[model samples]
Target: MTTDTDTALEVTPDAAAAEFDRQVRTLLALGYPALSGRSPEQFAALVAPLRAEAVARAGSAAYPAGPAGPETAPAVTGRVPFVLVVGRALAPVERTMPLTTLHGGRLPGFVDRSFEPGSLERFLATEEARPPGRDGVHLLCEVERGEEFCGVVPGDAMATVAERGRTPLTLEEGIALLTLFPEILVKNKCFSLGGSRCGDRRVPALWISKRAPKLGWCWEGNPHTWLGMASAGARHA
Candidate 1:
């Protein structure tokens, strides 16, 4: 879903770096400190590892598929469900999904594109009804590769390459790093909707996060791509 427009900023960095090196260097440049309100040195130290991790993973992880599709799990009833929408047909793939986030925002990498328009309205309406803090949000997700990313900035252990004099990364340090880079995520996977669309059609997973969606930021399907969604997940009433 889109960030609350008022919440959306003109200067907010790209959700993820499109061109990693240029983005990193621009943020690290001396004049760039104002972007994060941090000194250049401080900003550079925080984001370098994150850029490396994302780049490395994007380059290295391309394994052959073992299973033809995601396991056929069942829908969970009673507990809040994360509806895994894949095709134009709105159906549940799995339920009782467990997802976490750092900001009020959904962990990005769900998919780069936005969700359907009504998502935020539903989220706000649900939040207005809630006591406060817990999100019973509906999301129209255009999911991404789940095995690749996480919502939280990864721990210091992820800092593989380091400056000679600086201490290596740590958990506490990683958490603190968010003040500078809210987008950095721990290397982990979330539920993925990738390969759900086998044919040229594009479908979305309207998962209920904290609870799921029909976010307005959904990706428009390409006419050239055929849609093929797997029939996975259990159906419950």
Candidate 2:
């Protein structure tokens, strides 16, 4: 398993702060306000309090073990307490912005043409995906790329996650993770956002294609050697 947490780099309070700031700037530069319907100041205000604790919380939490095995967990380098998530309001362009912005115009992120907005809307978060905290824009805690579940069938991965008392990443959460840490979406080791699902077998996933990131779907029962399931430990304000 790859074991690359949020990003391939070690997480320190300083790194966390830098990354967090970068996300804000990136979102604004990319005109996130247009999609999110929140002003830059509003977004800035939401994260101001978090800045105060960045130093205290950074590199403090233990990295949880991956579902495949304990060894698949990354060493305890450091942890960013929260990941700023913009939610599902920008579902139509979530995947594209991250890829285009992060990749430096190499290749734009691709969304399957079949997933028209109406069809994409059907893939709601599973019951397990709901967090006890405010469900709108918020911070996600203990996020992981779920590398241990690589090569595991999406259906089996979901069952394993349930048995382990954890939640899989929703489509929005998955996009948020990638938008903040593009390095996690490397070739031959992509991930599925199994927390969001349609009535049938399709599982939303993010993968690399032509050296670019792609938002697509995979059958629940099929196992792909390149894809693992992404997950988060919890969500909060």
Candidate 3:
């Protein structure tokens, strides 16, 4: 009886924004160019529109109620499946940093605070949730990230957003989520970086990327990292 619907959560535009901001800041601090600019305010202004677009896309999707029936849909049993959709306008430049290179040799507390609680940690806990073989699709919304700019997920994929508490996302929270889940670090890929705004209103070009696997790092093969991001998103859901 388990279904995607049972695992899916409704998210709002505001909540998406908050998670995006949190993720972006985390990447910047971790030596990732997820967010490169002057001032927190400027960065916030740059990413807002992308977040809004993501929220809209998530809202419009017809996500599964839980695990689909054997004949009705693919069985997404075992660990709950979810997706983390990111939207940016620029691609990340090639760069590798030792653990010591991280600001203070570790992920800052602020970055931790931004994580969607148990999203990443929990998602990586199970083999079924790991990328490349996982059943779900993680979408990315990049303006110029790579060959798959704009939409990262296929048309047949099921999609939904993870909500925090009862409110939608704010810019800060969204960025924090990205920081906790840097798996979006695909090579030759970048997210949107610039946009227009009027007065206090800002327009972010929006970059998008999905959480996938690479061939490096201490925990590169483990699922812990992916689970961490998923767990965080679930908490918000």
Candidate 4:
């Protein structure tokens, strides 16, 4: 009595193991271990327990895609919780890395003028901004760019997210998403990290600038035609 739907949902042990291995290699290639000050072995050990869970979470269905059109469509929408984002490990200047595919010579990621040293830490420290797990590695499931909310004010969109029982992504989560999947931040489809706030009007966001990704902020009450708030369905230890 095994239906096709049930079969599709079942992940074989081999498939799960393969998924975990791919994630480990991908993170290593992205220099996650160095960013977190952990050896490759240590990093892999941390993520080992969540192998099957990560793969299942990554396969979960996502919300409707935005109107970025096929040209700018993301290869993958949801992040599989493999990124290791040490919030305080490096300054914003050193933390952000430009995508290798960007035109012109290699460029580094930059924080907006509105931010200063330790600014991100303070914002992330707020109880309102605290992530679901500890300050180290964690899992975020069904994370979306919230592109459907584009042109909608962040404050209003957050209210809507709450009504739907979804969680807005934190600053660390946003950083992780960009660090792992730079293609998701294409033109006219940037996202706001509304989950991280300092009890003010500002909402952190990631966007493309001069063919590079930039971590910046915008007014909570404002709306942008291109930037939508990001969110997650759940988080795990």
Q: What is the TM-score of each candidate against the true structure?
A: 0.21, 0.77, 0.30, 0.76
Q: List model 1 lDDT by residue over 169-214, tens digit each.
A: 1111111122122222222211212212222223232222331221
In candidate 4, what are the lDDT values of residues 132-197, reduced to their tens digit?
455455666666778888899999998888788787777777776776556567778889988888
User: Model 1, stretches more than 4 Å misplaced?
Assistant: 1-19, 28-32, 61-237
Q: Of models 1 and 4, which has the larger lDDT?
A: 4
Which rank order by lDDT, best down to worst? Answer: 2, 4, 3, 1
- The prediction achieving the highest lDDT against the true structure is 2
Give Cα distance to truth, residue 234, candidate 4, Å: 0.4
Count clashing pairs, candidate 3: 90
Q: What is the C-alpha RMSD of each candidate to the true structure, in Å?
A: 21.0, 6.1, 17.3, 6.4
Query: Residue 167 in model 4: shift from native, Å?
Result: 1.2
Candidate 2 or 1, higher TM-score: 2
Q: Let me know the TM-score candidate 3 reaches against the reference structure.
A: 0.30
Better of 1 and 2 by lDDT: 2
For residue 171, model 4's alpha carbon misses the true position, in angstroms, by 1.4
List clash counts for every candidate, in order.
45, 1, 90, 0
TM-score of 4: 0.76
